[model samples]
Target chain A: MATQDKSSIFADIDEGEVDQEDENVDRWRRNLRLWRETLAKQWRMLTDDLMVRLAMITIAFFMIVAVFAPFIAPRGPLTRQYEGDAGIIIADWVEPSFLSSESEYLLGTTAEGFDIFSQLVYGSRAALLVGLVAAVFTAGIGTLVGLTAGYYGGKIDDTLMRIVDFLYGMPLLPTVIILVALMGPSLWNILFAIIVLQWRSTARVIRSQALSLRERPFVKAAQVAGASDWHIISRHLAPNVLPLSFLYGAFAIAWAILAEAGVSFIGLGDPNTVSWGTMLQSSRAYSALDFGAWWWFIPPGICIGLVVISGFLIGRGYEEITNPELR
Target chain B: MSDTGAPDVSDENPLLRVEGLQKHFQINEGLISSLLRATMGKEADYVHAVDGVSFELERGETLGLAGESGCGKTTTGMSLVKLHEPTDGRIEFRGMDLTESDDEELDEFRQNAQMIFQDPFESLNPRMTVYDTLAEPLRIHDIENETARIRRALEFAELQPPDHYFDQYPHELSGGQRQRVAIARALVLDPDFIVADEPVSMLDVSLRAGVLSLMERMTEEFNLSVVYISHDLSLLRHMCDRLAIMYMGEIVEKGATEDIIENPQHPYTRSLINAVPVPDPDVGRERVELAGEVGDAIDVPSGCRFHGRCSEYIGDICETDSPSLEQKAEFDDDREVSCHLYDSCGKQS
Candidate 1:
């Protein structure tokens, strides 16, 4: 079990964990032990939950496909359908291999001759990339802003919170549509569009938390200890709010994945990308759904729904973690 | 002024001298209120959390501030450390006026003063280890020898084999152990004074004595001035050399601990001592049940704040005229009381 490997050689417990005394390896080792115990407790909570297990299994499956796309895919995402006599046809809709035994095509092909199976396999990469990157940046920015607003309060709080309110007042899809339109359509642009608007929820939730946390006696003790404002925010206040940050980060992954699909379905996706959104958009060219080409369209649609729902289920599991019941 | 009549052994320079310390929090805090007050001439309101309290301490003296909760005892302690900026008053530290002290002097004051908060569970950061909590103060003050200093503080706090606790988080330790870490952190900077706001009240009763004695030992070894704030009269009587009884953001009485506990002069003080529960069930005692709750601190009583609940409410004078803190010829030379019963109050009117 992962819990048993407390001393795992590659146990990187934190990204910016303070060593306190970098020279004291014993201190580091003890901290590692402490970190493992805490992580194990959280792991138990996650594993014990049925919804969380389903979410994990689904996400794990997508992750495997995403990570091994190059090795697993039999053809490139944008490869043309090459017929026996007329090779490399761009406008031919090939039949699905299951429909005909001798047909070379697997899960058929688009009018653009792009293989549906290859594109679906590689599409997981786009979904996870946008989901993970957007979630990270969203949580990171929100946490910093929340800490500053909550710690310094008064005018800074008013100003920052007003900005957040303004962003929230903006309609999400429409604003993201405008943002993607203005920034030019690409996978990263779509990711950026999601991030620009999505950080608001994390910021609001974390800001309210930071508001209460700053009033905690520990934060005041740090102040009485002669620590600077930045030091207190980073070392004391930020760490306390991190669990809440992670919870929001999980919800944001679900939001971002769904949003990317929405933007791409509106024909604003990266033309070169093989995301489920782009696959769905391209399926419309041959009216594959009207012609009942469920193989060409339904697989990508199901992948999108499964991944997004799994993200939400995992996010629900993490909510229990942030405000865990007394053990 | 030494309101508690604590002997001034170091008379030339008392460690701390506070005069008319007041901390009032404005209740209506918003743009709408400001607009109303500006355009419509509406009056602003305040909580009057700590109003016009004053005292002085010699180096190494332990002053106990005893009052019912919300009587501003904790606010008084917090003001001592500049945790809540005084609304209107002067706090002098070693002859330096804190209200007007520049950043450099304030920083010096911050280094010299520390506070151990009430709840150990809430006082120590959960994310930080014991070693990190202790090292934070030292690091902030630019002190060296981080490891040795942390070990010594743990030892001082009576945590045996201090190294064992070096990496333990707050949640992992018992309540008593967490309070010890808090004490260790407060004293790590070697500050001249510390404000302990009910430090052990949240601990198990069995653990309170051990933590209190640890603080006492820290005081003697370091010659530290401490302001112990608690509503527990017995605990204060045990820990404080001098005691000040607060009533509605004002010090109604203060004297040597024995005098306040034994020869309480103010009617309010007398009632407070009488309220302490006796352990012996066989012993019958006459209890003075206070007629009403503590008066509203915002719209404070016009006369003596305690007159509304005073057991010996003396006629119209008690209702109309405010009394100043004065020494009666009858009470101990060290004692002072702010009550209408004192003949000195008659002279003032």
Candidate 2:
């Protein structure tokens, strides 16, 4: 009997190991199938609406442009030169040939004879980076804090909400000024300022949504299933909260972009890097409106308008996907 | 009454023994001054949610715990599964003290004791397909050979043609089908005990009996000891082998089903039994209209919890000393009643 028991124990151990291997395989297979199904569903979503497809394509086009601007633009963005004949020029302004110069740049010349097209192309990179990165940082922090506050509603919730309220009361423009002054003006610093101020709204929205989701019976069922607190948050709570987060994140991206433009248009952004906002700043400083230099200012202004509009359209597309009720 | 002191004929061994269970929620003073009182030494009072409730369930027996809303019936059921930790007392399952178990042991105990929630519509994960929902417990408990286990569970729950339903999302299924899937999920782990918390209450009246029968069949087939909780007393009388009646967080009466229904001793029990709607059109029974609303469970009555609504209150004695459960002389061994009338009168002559 003792020998038989030992043999059975060994057999059980072997079976346990086999079972573990089988489960791993099964989980991988299941996850693969689930991914395929999700892809199929998203494909259906993409094909169903013209607006969503258009929005996606437009965003994609801008991203490609932003990535390959260095290769695409003809002249170096910062290099300046005196156009027409320098010898014939008076008071260091343009020469007689400037008005009728057939050998002009693609987007014409700026006040300093820099290529406007090159500046616009290169500025897209900074604007897009700051907007996307800032939105991601703010959304990630907001989601974590909101999920914690909403899932475990006690002193933690109260303290976090109080902090949100306190932050909400601060004047936006003045706060940005203070932050920029303290941290010094750079692309990364501007992104940081926008995220620090903007995360409160996302946190508030996420907390409200989470407050409703936490009371859901599935959450309690997950608790009774012997799931730990972390498992409950990640598995049960996070999936439901993600759609809302994505919706808010799209809007946050647009907001961050606008805020970055506002700061840089007022001369707080990096003076060296020619962002669209900085281009606008230089155009306004030189009074391109009074001088009628459409090539210098109009193109950069149009670029800013197109970027913000694309961000808004993308936000609307995401809103429709996350909330079918809205559709 | 049997000589072995076992209420049910199936087995003499008790699978679960709950003694003096209590759950009190401390209600903060008020909205305005609670913030101020937090800093001061003043303490918040409590709502006595599940005060001094006790019962025992033998192996393979269905014990129905019936009471109105806010009477702590659900709280009692949750306490057994350790969903809400009991404030005081002991719950012994399979001779192991549940309150004393560590986190690991408690987890093992949770695997042994499962729960079926009330709302079939909201209880399930709308995002998950029926297969994943059913397979979740098996995965969590580390059951071997997933395909076979899932097939067997689906078959056991009578989800016929498993292939047709396995890939279907929860929203596509009917309420009854969703509930069947929920039951399949609960049973997949092969648990020894299950807490059915108003499992059939949310279903249509026509569908209620079918769900109840399925539960009954599963209880016998799996040899599971169940604590079936509901507010419907007639259903309890039909489904359970033993019955425990709770009033304002206290079990006022408990006995075999026949004894509690046919010969209820406590006034609260009598009121509950009388409230059960009779099916026969000609049989006109006097509905015992309970006076006033149920008193605050937070501030329970001074003496007996049910004294505010009890019809047979015996003056100051009923108001002064709280009554403890005593065995009725007529059905001495089987039935217990908590009333001052029984305390002084000793036995009904």
Candidate 3:
């Protein structure tokens, strides 16, 4: 009976199979160890979250579309189509249909007989361009201003912060609209309006952080070492404040996009450019809603919502890193 | 212009001499009061953090500034290095008058005289790697060949396998290790003098010895003149060649460490030595209970700051007149005592 039990155990444990299985297990363990080490080295709370990952992916999708808009779009955003040589529109406000063939238009057609899918693909480029450029300009100016004010302190700090407060207190959207109107509805004008309004929050956050950081011993040590004021600000102070500015920059990008969309919706957007907001304006102007053409307005609205939401989600992810208490 | 009363023993000039060093911080008044004072053109109330403290440090000598918590030792040390910018004082370093020096001269003084702070964690920048922290002074001084200098500093600080510590940030290092990095930063510039303000007070008791020993080794290696400030008299006795005891911003006693430890003249110095805990069970020690809390620096006593808490309080003179430090011939070394008891005797003789 003992011999029989031993033989059965041996049959189950097959010697060659066990050896192969052990080697596989060792390789698996080694890979897991490598993954864990990499995670430990580069892990950040903001980027590690599943919600943030989804947000980043959404952002990446919009960015890809924006970048490849000219190639991916089937028709020119402004191109109009006609039924025959007489130029009578046949696909005006056609509903989206997957069953339609190439000539029927995949996302149907707008009231202007322009392809809706093409308009969307082209619109992302404008939205992302304005948002990113405005954010970069605001971050640069705000960081320089805040670093100077906080590091020098006393009168400089008081004067700059008071100016920031003045700007912060103004009605953001209305001011932006007024500025955009006065400057004329060009891309740079709209960007300027957004940047002027968005920089206050960045300056305020960076200034407060710089004020405390200036008191740290390392700064004092640098001073004792006779490092010049400019050197201290550019090297020591700037690097510390950059991470925080980046966190604020993410939020600022979302704000810029929303501001641009709002201005465009109110008819201040550049007429030459195609954007989600401009698409909405055109859809409304042509009475697409009254005509029950959901494809004309709904798609643009959804794209704006998706882009803004994704920007906010990415900003939130950065927030967990900058303000670690939230994690 | 009161005489410091120290007998001039040596003709050779000291490396650094501080005379009448005073640091007074203005206490903020209420908004209404400030307006009123501004209109009246009156000066605000001030806290005399370090008031009329004077001492000299010779080359290659470690002078320990021993005192209680609020005795202004740290202030004295910081002001000596021009860190706090002495409110009023004459700091002469290596024959250069620091107070009268131009920006360039002051910068030159700063390069030669560096300070090591108390808290190791706070002293080193959290964002900086060990390499950057060590290289900052070298870079600020505009020294060439930074890479080789940083490596030498790492080894000099006794952080073996210097590469391991070069990339590590302050937070990654242990307290002892961080303090060692701070020491390395001080040494990298090869400064002739260092003001170490309670360098090991924030460290664990077990770690203090190692850090202190490393500092001692550096002192020998670098020929550094250090003003080592600490409340621990035992540590001071172990480290310092000469000891200066401060009381309420005033140096009450100054002499060789062994001479002062063996024969404490001033009542405050005697009390300080008595306060140090003795480990022997067979030997009984008299505990000198320092009376009341140290009074507010803003409201220092009229005569002597230690009079209120003194064990050997003399007569009405002790309360009426402040005593100036005087050299006594009774002791073998050039021991200076500032108690009314000794000063009155010296005056009579």
Candidate 4:
């Protein structure tokens, strides 16, 4: 009887091992197939939408312009130089006689002898950098705070939300003005200001999302699975809020760009840098309206408009991808 | 009895033991009103969710905890697993005091003690496919070669032909399939114990029996100790080795399943048993209609917690001094009751 019992136990153990091996092989195959399915779905979405394709092209153009500004611009953006017999590059482009009797700059030039086209192209680098970086900074901070506060409600949530409310209620324009005054006007400083002001709204949205998500059974499952607070926030909670983050990030970039331009137009921008807002400020300083030099302001204004429009399109595309119910 | 019967492990050898567990939620009235009420000395009111509950489970045994809604059955389960911080209690799992364990220790304890939630539909993450969901616990517990373990666990839960299910999302699967995935996820870590919180209650009646039988099989195959919580006493009796009946956050009666079902001493237990729908059409068992709704746990009755609703109340003593759970005189070995009627009945004899 003892020998038979031992033999049966060994047989059971052997059977379990066989079952386990078979299961492992099956699981690997299933994971591969699911991943392929998800990838296929995303690929279909990418190819199907015209608006999404347009937004992608515009983003690609902006990125290329930003990356290859030196090669694309006619002259160094910051250098003040003149062609022979021309007052400066700007005069050469705008005044027909400055470069040659028969020559005309296609896009004209500023009164300071700088090429308007070149400045418009090069200015994109700074605007794109500030917009992308500042939006990322704002979104990252907001997502973390929102995720933490939302996932772990009670005192932490109350305190963080109160801070968000206080910030949201503050006069945003005046706060930016004061921030510029304290930090001094520079690209990085302006970026900092935009992020500080912008993070609150994202935090509020994320917090509300987190509040709803924290009570979800998946979150409870994560908790029971011995997941740490950080693990639960990152693995289960963060992914759900990511689509919202992407949408908010794009919108925030557009807002930041507009705000930067507004501050520069109001004479709060760096005196050394040549941003679209600074171009407007310089044009205003030269009394371009009085002199009728349309070359100075129109190109920069158009660039700003185009960038903001592109940002909105990208944001809309992200909204479509994130919200399947809407789709 | 002498202290040598089971080596007196009641004080030392319990695998999981809970004592005097309570959870109270403070009601926050509107701001101005609450402030005024605070000054008037009626500052706060509480919902005594789990009020002074206690129970024990030995290693390798399934303890079925059953009670009606709002009776703190789920709360008791949650407290044992530390899902909610107990208002007051000592929970010992494998002789380690859970209440005093620090965060690191609690984390370690959690890896050993997992919970399977009720709702199969909502419990799993919608974003993750079956593979990632199963892989999550294994990754969290640092289980090695997770792919192999996940497959093994899935098979253990009887989700056979594991390849077909490996890629399927919860939405794609049927209700039974999703529950199997839930159980597989819980079992991935090779946990020593599990808290199944009404695991099969939400499934169809036909599907419920399958899930219940699967759990029993897993319990034996894995040699796992479990706390099977539910409102279905009949299912509990079928699946559990021991049974504890909770009423308003306290266990009114507890014993081996056979003993408790055959001869329930507490009025509350008898009522619950009567309420269990008789499956046979011909056997018309009299349904004991309980008096009043279940009492408020926050401000429970004066003496006995069940006195207000108990049908077999033994006079004013039932209203003034709460009866303590003691071994019944008739059953020398395995049964306990906390009711004045039992005590008075004994005295009369």
What DockQ values do the models have?
0.27, 0.28, 0.16, 0.33
Model 3: pairs clashing at backbone N, Cα or C within 3 Å: none
Off by over 4 Å in 1: A1-54, A57-61, A82-91, A325-327, B1-11, B29-34, B280-286, B345-349
Candidate with maximal lDDT: 1
Residue B20, candidate 3: alpha-carbon lDDT: 87
Candidate 4: the clashing residue pairs are A90-A113, A90-A114
**CA-only RMSD, every prediction:** 8.0, 5.4, 13.9, 5.4
- DockQ, ranked from best to worst: 4, 2, 1, 3
**Ten contiguous residues minimizing lDDT sum, candidate 4 chain A:** A1-10
Reference-based TM-score, model 3: 0.86
* Whole-model lDDT values for every prediction: 0.83, 0.77, 0.80, 0.79
Looking at model 1, the pairs that clash are none
List, residue by residue over A193-236, the lDDT tens digit for candidate 2: 88888889889988887888877777777666777777777767
User: Model 4 scores what on Cα lDDT?
Assistant: 0.79
Task: Determine the C-alpha RMSD for candidate 1 after optimal superposition of all C-alphas.
Answer: 8.0
lDDT of 2 by residue, B1-349 (tens): 1123222322334778898999888785556788777778676778888998888887678999988898999889989998888999889875568889877667667676888999988888876777777667666666566555566667667788776787787789988888888888787766778999999888888887778888888887777889989988888888899999988898888889888998888898888889888889999887787888878886678988788888988798778888887675555556778887764336421
Docking class of 2: acceptable
Instruction: For residues A1-327, write the lDDT of model 3, one tens digit per residue.
Output: 111212211222233343343322233454466456545653455568888888888888999999999999988998875454446644356657674455467678887778889999999998899878877878887898889899988789889988999998888889988998899997779888888878888888788878988887778778778889998888688977877787777777788888888888888998888898888888888888888878788988988888788878887887777677988
The runs of at least 3 residues in candidate 2 whose Cα sits more than 4 Å from the true structure, single-residue gaps closed, are A1-25, A39-43, A46-49, A83-103, B1-13, B28-32, B38-42, B343-349
